[model samples]
Target: MSSLQFNAVLLEISNQLSAEQLEQIKFLCRDMIRKRELETIDTGRKLFNILTERGRLGADNKECLCELLREIQRHDLSDKLNRFESQSGSTDNQPDDEEKAKLDIATEVISENLGKSWRKLGRKLGLTDVKLESIYKRHPTELEEMAVELLKEWRKIRGAEARTEELIKALRACQYNLTADKVEHRLATR
Candidate 1:
């Protein structure tokens, strides 16, 4: 999903929220949003824009919003968001042949350089602990394969939002700066 699409989703979700729920969201985000600013805001779109501007919401990251929805006991809204994400992936109609080839090469380079830090990168990429354990169990002695599998799983979950930049960010977050640079250089030179 693009930021525009993500914003649309957030707006749709915000429209569904009750006034009390909006206040609750503002309260929950007190630390990140200033009290004066919160008082001035009375709409979900504004709050979402602030969050997005702060890097708290995006196509590659929706955890905060999802958690907020769940915290507010709005599982239905959360599900609505998730459904949009999954369907957006399909509507994107898959990558072209060239993009697919580039992704394959990038994945190969990332998997090899990732080494034993695959799990850390996986966690940073939003893979659950249980999913990481399952991947590990499936390839106890194969580091490269484990890394590739983890990347594949992440790609599956992220779908259209799965970009090389997001992978680079996750790699850097896991302290794999060299690997991230390599990935960026590789994609650039391609």
Candidate 2:
């Protein structure tokens, strides 16, 4: 059954209980919720049995029952607030390291290929050269973009025919060229 419906029933029970009996009920509900066993129909049945057996849900127990219901509602509301904060990412105090590394690498690669020294690039990007270098070190995937840019620059300098021939030789001698597949495999194995 829904938590709201269950809560309504608990409230009804609370109206018929005494303060001490309500405390007992609150303690039991807290224990059940903590154990993750309070969501089952059988748990509700067990609760009802306990109340009936103890004469805690009768006319004499009304005040206690109400107090217990309030406690349970308070606990439920606290749990809901916690969940909402967590889902909204408001509870995460730290940035994801891996994601930050990737972004840093991408920025470094772009700066390198664009023919700007890291210090110059850093000035333009509003970061320090050391910070840019650190990013490249952490996420080497950035090298792929730099390699592509290097090839484009080489083509412009050496002409298409020479650049194509050099690339073919580099591909064949995998050790000589920093290709994406080889770099990725090396990184993964390391």
Candidate 3:
């Protein structure tokens, strides 16, 4: 969603909250979006996806969502949403992180298309099949936590985007270096 639409959703949800609760939510929201840059919340990811066409925030709490909108400078939408609520109107649409969570497996990671191969990432992360099996055999919870941490780190690293950009640069460079050795001979003969 656009920042305005997102802010409207947040305001709608906040209308059900108390002043104290709102303060807490705001603080948590910031923590979710900015504080825990490496540590991600499912809500934050979902919020980001929605905005970025994947459908996704920070602080670690609800209020941080509002803080995020403000950080992006969408106060106008926040104002309009709250105003609309006061006028006995309701936004019908709201963020459904909880519902989305229920629908999902809760273990989805971000892009890996250009990142390491799954087997390679598993080895690099020290969570290889053998390693994971060993951990699960001795400590299920430990394995779970390790997997979660690795996924969080993956979310923070834009490996796929970086790789794509690198590929594009390389392609452009190749376009300028079109003098193949065989082609050069043909041109010289011409």
lDDT top scorer: 1
For model 1, give the RMSD to the true fold: 13.1
Residue-level lDDT of model 2, residues 129-161, one tens digit each, is: 333443344445655454443433332223223
- Model 1, which residues run further than 4 Å from truth? 1-93, 96-98
Alpha-carbon local distance difference test for all models: 0.81, 0.40, 0.37
lDDT of 2: 0.40
- List all candidate RMSDs to the true structure: 13.1, 22.4, 18.5
lDDT of 3 by residue, 1-190 (tens): 3456555555454443444543443454463345553234334333443333312342122333445544544443334343433333333333255433321222232121212222334344333354334323343445445544444333223222223222223323444222223233333453
TM-score of 3: 0.19
TM-score of 2: 0.20
Measured by TM-score, the strongest candidate is 1
The reply for model 2, stretches above 4 Å from the true place, is: 1-42, 74-190
Q: Candidate 3 overall Cα lDDT vs. reference? A: 0.37
What ranges in model 3 sit over 4 Å off? 1-30, 33-45, 48-63, 89-190
Q: 23-136, model 1: which lDDT tens digit per residue?
A: 998889999888998998889989988888888988788889888888877765676577678778776745566766666877999988888878888889888776687678
